[model samples]
Target: MKISNRSTSTGRRRTSAAVALGAVLALTATACGDDGSGGGEGAEGSGKGKIVFWDNNGGVRTDIWKEIIADFEKANPDIDVQYVGIASTEYQSKVDTAIQGGGLPDVGGVGAAMLAGFAAQNALEPLDGRLAKSSLNGKLNKDMIESLKAAGGGDDKLYSIPTSANNGVLYYRTDLFKKAGLAEPTTWENFYKAAEKLTDKSKNAFGYTIRGGAGSIAQALDAMYGQSGITSFWDSSGEKTTVNDPKNVAALEKYAGLYKKVTPAADLNNDFTKMVAQWDSGTIGMLNHNLGSYQDHVKALGVDKFRGVPQPTGPGGRRVQVSNPVDGLGLFKSSKNKEAAWKFIEFALSHEVNSRFNESAGQVPANLEAAKDPWIEKAEPTKLAARALSDGSTSIVQLPYYLPDWNTISKADNEPNFQKVLLGKLSAKDFLDKMAEQLNEAQKEWKQQNG
Candidate 1:
């Protein structure tokens, strides 16, 4: 989720390791030829041939990529997929280096956060026309596609095809809620009331855990907008943010106030992992996390003890939540095997294939048919999230992913300020205002450049 910059040496080291460790499908030059099956644009080696792919987020994702690549090759024996696994810390720099020195892979991870940089550098191949003619045209999730398009530097061209989305869930302890004679935490009012009533300082029990450390910004934004019923990230002019609106400031006031009173004191520095640990080990009332940890909670507490649900509704009974960063694949403009690369992308996103990938990744598959696989219906959070997203019960507030500096502003510039807000060292309004200034400036810069 956090793809950061790195030194040239570190990037080269990681890139070499990627090639050496997992380029199993590397094809000989004789395997390269145009077969015209993918109906793509490009030069001679454009069809049923071989293409190299770089996994932008390696380490955790390498094994799954290997499986996907193998399956893709089995389906299309003529198309060979060479997998390069680059750790996330070095991914961006490695790609940048490739762009400068002339070695961009045929395809690679173009996740929403990194899409802007790739598009900005003109490194991505536009896939709008190609996709419309392919089998995947109408089968992909519309929202996920829009998120990718917005991230593609505002050019309205499809550069990356989304594979899956991670949605946030409000996890509540059913056992604790039942014992306390409280209703399900379906609304913000009920959530706060339960949090206050469930705390027992003498016994080391608490109602909630706050992620005041790394990756705090996304959760906070969801809470603010979900409570305020704000659906749009931008205002009417489309050149500014609605994050620091007065209504959101009021919402943040109440959300941040729960830090010390009902949450553990250690929450002042807890990140998602630590916050989830506290929720799993303690008698906390609720946790705001994505589906990635559902298995952990199930293992620790058993399935009957907890349940994952969409975020509680706001005053208007509307469910508005921020979209977790979506991961997608992009074809490089420099790919000599464009048609083959496109076939690999299409093959990977096919119903059964995409299901396999998202199953291992623990995410909601972007392919509509793949989303309906029996496994998603059985997974705790993924089931509810996939259903809600597909049925239109939940509305998503897309972040300004087109802003190239968004990650820096959210993680580096504001994480400390957010912790201050939780610790009472700063007011909620001031914190939101600081974020608003940075966001508005970034928006202006983006519009100027794109226009």
Candidate 2:
């Protein structure tokens, strides 16, 4: 998925706008209290009550959470559920208001990028101790769990468990490649040549496309960083940013080189939406996008017409995918219903619920058992993704607090400067120096406000 700098809107919070489609449970503050009846920390000492849930209204995977809510209510009749779906774009501001007034939901879903920022502000409750005793915790993907732990930082505490996610991979047109006498590229050099050969003026086609937009560049940077085999962006333990290092410079330079050939000059304006349009029009041979695009393309082009492969190797010969378990359900720090919330989490990740969700929604299942799920095995893209996750070819990076601004800087600063290098306006070394300067300044300013 693209790393967006814009705040999450309420509508984007839940990909689906559908209501619970179940009974509307009454809202009562007494429901989520920390009573002795297995209700949790900071909850009121009440025995029986309802749990209020706030979900993203228009996410691509909205129905999964809806179904989970229905199933949870059916299983636990004593617990009442009050559901409110929020749009993603307005979610952060809505949440900010709620947080300031101490009126958060009992349980809610959050984007992975914002998880750390919340934890840092003491807006999230640590789930490590509670989750450790659950039978389902061990069945989650280790890399996903590690990503969450890394995002939490300091104590390796888990603030939330991933429910679903998206990842980036190279989408190629096999038919075009065959006609052009090319194989799916395994390295950057070959990929460039393939793009040139694929680009036919008469055919109105190009080799590949990328989101030159900030979100796209950040995703590309994550992909490039992974291929460079550098694990951490900044070592909080060490207290320094390695963005100015020679290795990073080399990676940036390599990207600048490739930007000259395959990618369109209008990349600065391109985002996932525009890139996908090019792919749909058959005007681009390859593009980088998330799992949703994988499913969407397969549906549009036919299962055998397209395929997803690991991103090509960089100059350093490393492979990586920019992805993480981003969708998750978490209880608010101000929540009163601990038991109700945990019950929702458990039911959401249960074998049956997870499988049903993955089957219809076309996502890689968060539950490990869901990996072997029949829906995954039956679908071409899901099958490929399942194998990729199992083999550890994916890189799920922890987004830092200043992600919004970081995304902007990567685009507003590095992209134009790098584009200058591609257009022969500057040398790679000059581009790298300018990029490092901007990134360093961004890092410094971010620390001042968030750290």
lDDT of 1 by residue, 1-451 (tens): 1134322223423443233122121111112123212222234364766688899768657888898888888888888787889975467767765655455678888888778766765667788998999999999999889989988878898899999888899999999999999999888889999899999988888888888887789999999999998899999999889999999999999999999899899998887768888899988889998876787688789999999988988867878899788889998766668788888899889999899888876688999998878888778688778777778767889888887667667766788889999988999999998888878877876777678
Q: Report lDDT (Cα) of residue 365, candidate 1.
A: 91
Off by over 4 Å in 2: 1-57, 74-98, 101-103, 133-137, 226-240, 250-267, 315-317, 320-326, 359-363, 379-451
| All models, RMSD in angstroms | 7.5, 8.4
Total clashes for model 1 = 1
lDDT of 2 by residue, 1-451 (tens): 1223323333222311221111011112112343312222356324246777778534545666677777787888787777777764456556544543345677777656556545544556677776788878688777666666665534567888777755656788888888888977767677778878887656567787756643555555664565566656665643455555577667756665556366666765666666677687666788777666666686678777677766676645655544443667776655666766777777888877877776765677778888677666667656766666667655544445333234334544456655555566887566655555555554554455446
Reference-based lDDT, residue 8, model 2: 30
* Clash totals, every prediction: 1, 38
Taken over the whole model, the C-alpha lDDT of each candidate is 0.79, 0.61
lDDT of 2 at 119: 54
Q: What is the TM-score of each candidate against the true structure?
A: 0.79, 0.72
